[model samples]
Target: MVLGAVVLWELLAAFLERTMDESVYEYLDFVDATDSRIPRRSTRAPGLAKALSLLRGDGRALLFAGTVFLVGAAGSAGHNFLLWQLQDQGSSGLLMGLWVGLGPLAELALHPLRGQLLRALPGCGLELLSLAVLAAQLLSYSLLRAPWAALPVQALSGLSSGALRWRLQGTVGDVATPGSERALLALLGGLCAAGAGLGGLGGGFVLQRFGLALLLQASCAGLGLWILFVLIVRSRLPRRRKINYSRLLAAESSEMSDSEEENEDWLVKAMRDESFNRNWIQQHGIK
Candidate 1:
């Protein structure tokens, strides 16, 4: 039923795309404008070598990539062991499914308050706190023998994994170069996949030999060490400047005449100019 629903959803999406007017997709204007401004000589997709060089040039991006890898590994290890731990505690398949579903439900519940949470906590600070929460969740999983007792710990996924994803995307956007944003994000995805694979392999090995308790305990300890390392390293690095996007957009909109606003060429030019200004500001390290 789930697979059929997914297939039907895809068909509906395809139909909508074919039937919808191009003008209705407003975000496409940004993509078109960006492409229009690119030099004919440099219109090719970003090469892997260029992307790697870009990553290497940005200190914050490098740090973020390393942090993402570690977090991914720890998160994957915990997830892979969760069912096994529950099964050992004599949890039925239905109960185990509920345990798995609760995390995403908690994440969904957090969506409404995400903006307020982001406003209340700085990005890096929120990320660190999320890591701490994740550590706690792992510790709970390690120690709790009662399947029901461990169910509450899954709710921590909202503040931990969910928040981490939000922070990671925002941080990537902040650090990435104008044209290199996609490449950097793709790199982030690659790191996540690699980390998860390694985590699953190593976790399974330990779980098979030493047991789930030992694996979860070790994951918790390693994550704790990573959190400390990130704290120290992040403190020594320069703080990321938050872009006032609302202000930038308002200023741009105010400067445009009504006739210019109506012109698609003018709109595209304005977006291109905004992109150029952002690139300049990032490159120059202007406060």
Candidate 2:
């Protein structure tokens, strides 16, 4: 059904662009509406004349779509759980974003090898690291009376989260082959959406019934189970090569080392061009 909708959207978007000369956002709206009303199965009809929309097939469009996708999910997660802390801890949606952004910040050391390392490692490894931190953070969150002291725990959760997230996506992509990629990606996306939807529901339930302490304890234990599952089951996924993070960033800089000038040149260039270095500075502002 989704695939058929994609095809229909492609056709309608093509025709609408040619006749109405619409914007991509307009096309998006039309397609969204169409998606809502898409019946079981019925097709045939090329629609109107073709028009090459600016946003449809462009190379940069894919990048934009991917970014929009991730940001939407991340934003939703923040609004659901962390935003609730505002009543007691003065935590807002923005605060949650700021704090969780820390884990990704800490992963600066692992950025270059993200895809490579994820493909090499088990999904369980990332899940375990994430759950361990999440468990600890949640425990601290419930234990501390001081909200300011607890805020750093959220940041720690974020750092661990960032690494786990990056690894998860990479591993999921790696798990599905060319033959099954589309269905696998769709399944993965649906699972994510389902989880988020459940989280929204479950989070509210926790706040209402069990209270913070019980909720935190449950969250910790739940994540701990995730760690166990990953360690036992996901660790056995098919792998082409083994990855070693420590070896990649070696301390024995005795052989085939770059000159001081070359190293300094790269460092300076990176510092000048990098823009994502804001998360660290933004985190403290949340508390």
Candidate 3:
């Protein structure tokens, strides 16, 4: 059923893309033509070596990647232990399915509030909050005895997993150069897979030897330590201002279309003027 849903979603996206107005593509082309800063699409795809070189050269990107790897590891370990713990407590298959389903439902509930959350907490703040929520979930799982109790704990997955995924994408876009976005994202994906593989392997060994409780507790402790380390390092590092790409793109698009500019909503007009756009981008510390 899940696979079917995913397939349907992809088909829907492809349909929408195909049916979209050609003028929209033209406008995007105009924006790219006008904006010298916009990275041109490269003919050759970036390789793994290029992606690794990006991480090596960019300190902030490297730090973010490390955090992602640790989060993936801890998250994978906790998830495996959660199912095992539930089984040990004699949870029915139906209850286990419900527990797993609740996470995505929680994420759906939070989707409407994502913009507000992003506005309220910029930079790595949201990412840190997600990690903290994950830690709490881990701690709760460690102490869980009742199968039903796992449902509520799994709901935190929305904030921890969903929000982390969102912020990680934004962070990557912010740090990535024009042509490196795909490569960087691919690198992060590989890192996440590696982390998950190791986590499952080591977690299984620990679960067999030390039991589920110790596995959960130790994963929680390790994650907590990582959170603390990130906090310290973040405090010491200079903060980089993030660009609101959506707004910038909208403004640029509106400016490029003179006819549309006059009919644009008030919000678009706010940044419609060239001077205003420049000032806005500058204020956001974009070169």
Candidate 4:
């Protein structure tokens, strides 16, 4: 269904020739002095070396990565317990579908307003708020007797998910090098996946050994640890600086142009050298 939606959107967009607003780019831009002009090279599939380099070079980046990993881990743990709770409650398939779908829909409904919200609150604030909401949702799941009661909670849960996603994207813009966004995104995604796997493994053990209530409680504690990390990092970081995105855009354009010119010059030089070698060989009666 996601693939179908992507294809449908692409077809419609091509038919409409709809131009995106400049504000989209403004929201998505990241700047770094050490970044290279060869975006295609930087944006290639990230390797272990790149991840190591990123972690070893920047302590703050390491903290951010750790936070993401913890969040993913806790979320997956909560999810396992949530499924178990719903199953125990004998939730109907249709009701389960509604519970699952409504949250992302609520999130999608709020995307247009995310920009204004970010202006009013820092990304960390949004992240903290999302964590708070997730905590509430888990509490609801723990307390609510009926599975249907958890349906409305899913909407708010979706809102938290959306907020976190928006904050993460903004973090990428804030921290990623201009040309390395794709690679950085890939690295973060892998970490989240790994964390989720670990969480799932632990959650299953806890559920089988203890019970569902204990699992939910443990997930809450995990989220608390994640919140602590976020708070510590947020407190340490300097005040947010306003970025001049227009200047960054111009700089990126100029950088791309210079890189292309350099590549062309290299090609020309290589051709000239090859021709000179051929001529010299003919004159000297060499093969």
Ranking by lDDT: 3, 1, 4, 2
Model 2: CA > 4 A from native: 1-79, 90-123, 157-159, 234-287
Question: In model 3, what are the clashing residue pairs, if there are any?
Answer: none
lDDT of 4 by residue, 151-215 (tens): 88887865577887887788777676544565677788888899889988987898799976777
Distance from true position, residue 37, model 1, in Å? 7.9
Model 2 earns a TM-score of 0.47
Query: Which predicted model would earn the best TM-score?
Result: 1
- The better-scoring model by lDDT among 3 and 4 is 3
Sort all candidates by TM-score, best to worst. 1, 3, 4, 2
Assess every candidate by TM-score.
0.71, 0.47, 0.69, 0.65
Query: Model 2 over residues 1-287: C-alpha lDDT tens digits?
Result: 99999999999998976567446434654565577786322431211111112223333322222332332343333445544554466656665666656545656755676666555655345545655765676667667664456456655644455655675466435444322333434444554576656655676677688775676667666666645654554335444566776776674353336566688899998886664456655766753
Runs in model 1 lying further than 4 Å from the true structure: 1-47, 240-287
Model 4 lDDT, full chain set: 0.75
Off by over 4 Å in 3: 1-45, 241-287
lDDT of 2 at 187: 45
Indicate whether candidate 1 or candidate 4 has the larger TM-score: 1
| Global lDDT of each candidate | 0.80, 0.53, 0.81, 0.75
lDDT, candidate 3, 1-287, per-residue tens: 99999999999998887668446655655576567665555433445777888788766677778878877888887767678778889999999999889999999999898988888888778888888898888889889879999888898888998898888788777767765676678799889888888888888898899987787788788878888887888788776676999999999887889666565765566656767889899999988
